[model samples]
Target: MRTDSEIKSDILEELAWQPNVDETEIGVVVEDGTVMLTGVLDDYRKKVAAEDAVKNVRGVKALVGDIQVKYGANYQKTDLEISKAIVKAFEWNTAVPEDEISVEVRDGWVNLSGEVDWAYQKDAAKRVAENIIGVKWINNAITIKQSIQPADVKEQINKAFLRSADIEANAITVEATEGLVKLFGTVHSIAEKKAAEDAAYLSPGVHIVINELEVID
Candidate 1:
């Protein structure tokens, strides 16, 4: 097991290496295996980048990001302007169903609520919103339209794991109840853990994925 200090050092180094994040503006605290980040950045994307950097570090069990996004005067936008921008962004993205999603902005935070046929579409909406300037944060409440529960949902996900190069199918177990899927196992890295969760989400009728996979590396 890696010590907290060792984990902290690696997190700092990872943050510095990420081009989108300014490492000096952030504070890192590690206790046990959880890391807490506190800082302020000019863009919401930077905050996300910082969080991703920490998660990629080995030995990090969890993260608490208290990073604040305070846009400068030049980057500030009215709620109406933000709303318009989000609408335009959704239209440009082919993956998102523009008409099916609703957008509301308040104090630079975008709230997305609607229904989509696929998890990727819901994720696409949030991804588009995250890149828009002046967006402080996003609440992706867009839900996947549930269909008939597949009797072999768990088996289908297991097959997907076998086909994917990023996942080790043997190390993971899949459980499905109704439309919810639970993953329990061990992965060699954080990336692999995420891959396992994403594969589960891709399975039809999987409304929620509970990833309890431990990163063993």
Candidate 2:
């Protein structure tokens, strides 16, 4: 097992490798593979980039983001403007149902709440929120409501995990209730755990995937 100091050094190196993030402004501290990010960034996108960069590090178990979004003078937007921008942006996306999603902005943080039939649609809405320039943060509260028989959901997800090249099928377990699926097991990496969850979401009638897959690497 790698020491916390080794993990911290790797996270810093990962941060430096990310082109979008200003590594000098960020601080990282690790304890038993848990990483805490501090300091400030110019945009919400960069903050996200920093987190994404760190997650790819081998020893990182979990992340706590304490990084602040320090909006530059040119990037500031009123709540109404932010709401309007996000709404307009979503309108242009083919995968996202513009009318089905509602945008609420308070203090430059965007809140997206709506219902969509597919998990991908909910994810599309969140991507739109994340790319907007003035967005300090995003709360993707979009819910999925699909018409699928609950019994078939588990079988379908199990088959998918078996098919996926990245995931170890036997190590993971799946449970389904209505449209919600709960995953429990251990995986080799964060990427594999995400792949298992993606497989669960691909199964029809799945609205929420409660991923309890632990990364054992």
Candidate 3:
């Protein structure tokens, strides 16, 4: 446990160490482990960097950043650039389903909605949206679809299993039904078990992976 003063000091130290931030330019207020940052930054990236610096601190309960940026006046143009940046980021990412996801911008706020096959894709979508300039906030309304075909699912699971060196292909039992893959087998360690599951997840049509594989001690 850390005292409020200790947490405040830690927050300030972290912010000072961040790239392009001057310690003298930043002011911090602490009340019961919640930090409020007040300062002026040269650009939007520094504004974001300042907030992120405090966010990753170990004892930080919450962050309220009131940092003003010189670029705030050009927010409308910034918003358009941010929207374009987010679109380009997703278009090149293989894990993201760009066709299923739609990015809408309103007053520098981004709203993302659509269906994706995995939880990782949902997280990735949010990250891309946040990196865009002029983005005051993001609304993530992505849904996950767990329905897929059995034969296609099975083939994908088999390919994933065979890709691993530790998985004894002959002993592995994989069954896919309605986009859900159920694995029943023995693996040497927990790492192998996780790898096997991840491999199945990367398959194009897989919606859910259920690992029933036993780990040997």
Put down candidate 3 lDDT per residue, 142-185, tens digits, no spaces: 76676557787788678767777856665678987766678888
What are the per-model C-alpha RMSD values against the true structure?
A: 1.5, 1.5, 9.6
RMSD of 2: 1.5
Separately for all candidates shown, the number of backbone clashes (residues 3 or more apart, or on different chains) is: 0, 0, 0
In angstroms, the error of model 2 at 124 is 0.8
Q: Model 1, which residues run further than 4 Å from truth?
A: none
Clashing pairs in 2: none
- Give residue 139's lDDT in candidate 1 (0 to 100): 93
Cα lDDT, model 3, residue 122: 71
Residue runs of model 3 more than 4 Å from their true location after superposition: 22-26, 39-47, 65-81, 146-217
Q: What are the per-residue Cα lDDT tens digits for candidate 2 across 50-148?
A: 988887887777789999886888888888888888888888999899989888898988888988888778888888888888888888888888788
Q: What shift in Å separates residue 97 of candidate 1 from its native position after superposition?
A: 0.6
How would you order the candidates by lDDT, starting with the best? 1, 2, 3
**For model 2, where is the 10-residue window of minimal lDDT?**
187-196
Q: List the residue pairs that clash in candidate 3.
A: none
User: Candidate 1: global Cα-lDDT?
Assistant: 0.88
* Number of the predicted model whose lDDT against the real structure is largest: 1
Q: After superposing candidate 2 on the true structure, give the runs of residues whose Cα lies further than 4 Å from its correct spot.
A: none
Question: By lDDT, is 2 or 3 better?
Answer: 2
